[model samples]
Target: MDFPETVRWTFAGLACLTLAALVREIRRLRRAEPGGRARVRWDAADQGAGLVLTVGGALGSLHLFGAGLVLTGVVLGGKAVRAVRARRRTTVGRPST
Candidate 1:
């Protein structure tokens, strides 16, 4: 494959892997009895996975629609960060149930 095609495919593969891991983690969390720490960790992982996939998708489609993907990813990432921060602030000093 050409260099650009190779790069796009590579990014696509990585994105798929990241998305799969995220799904697996979500399923595990749903099936098991998890503590607050575990839940928080999962939440963080979820956001990270989302970011990874978004970036990968943007890079993979660099020839077309890449700009839109990048923009969407940035917006989503920002929202996730803000949400996480707000959640942490609200949960501070509270007992985990």
Candidate 2:
């Protein structure tokens, strides 16, 4: 399948944005005080999933791989989102230090 140049560029742009967001989140996580082991694990998983998704998106646009990777990325991304929401709910009533 021939993808238009614009489609490729758009994917590239999204990949760049995802990378930036991943970096920012990592920095924030590092600065935060060590929390529960599960929270840390979830954050690490989220970062890993984001990286995979970004790569999948970029490769999909270039037609270097099939939609399988993209689908996997999407699934992982959804898990990350759910984990984050669950974490937030668990912490909502806690008082800030």
Question: Each candidate: how many clashes?
Answer: 0, 0
Q: Mind giving the per-residue lDDT tens digits that candidate 1 earns over 23-91?
A: 766666677665544555545465454545455554653433455455456656766886799799999
lDDT by residue (tens digit), candidate 2, 1-97:
4556776677678778767776876776777776654455455556555556556555553333344356556656766887789899999999999
Models 1 onward score TM values of 0.42, 0.51
Q: Please, what is the whole-model Cα lDDT of each candidate in the order they appear?
A: 0.60, 0.63
List where candidate 2 sits over 4 angstroms from the true fold. Answer: 61-97
Pairs of residues at least 3 apart in sequence or in different chains that clash in candidate 2: none
Report the C-alpha displacement of residue 74, candidate 2, in angstroms: 8.6
> Could you report the Cα RMSD, in angstroms, for every candidate shown?
7.2, 6.5
Instruction: Give the top-scoring candidate (TM-score).
Output: 2
| Candidate 2 least-lDDT 10 residues | 60-69
Error of 1 at 76 (Å): 17
Task: List residue ranges in candidate 1 displaced over 4 A.
Answer: 1-3, 36-97
Q: How close is candidate 2 to the true structure, as a TM-score?
A: 0.51
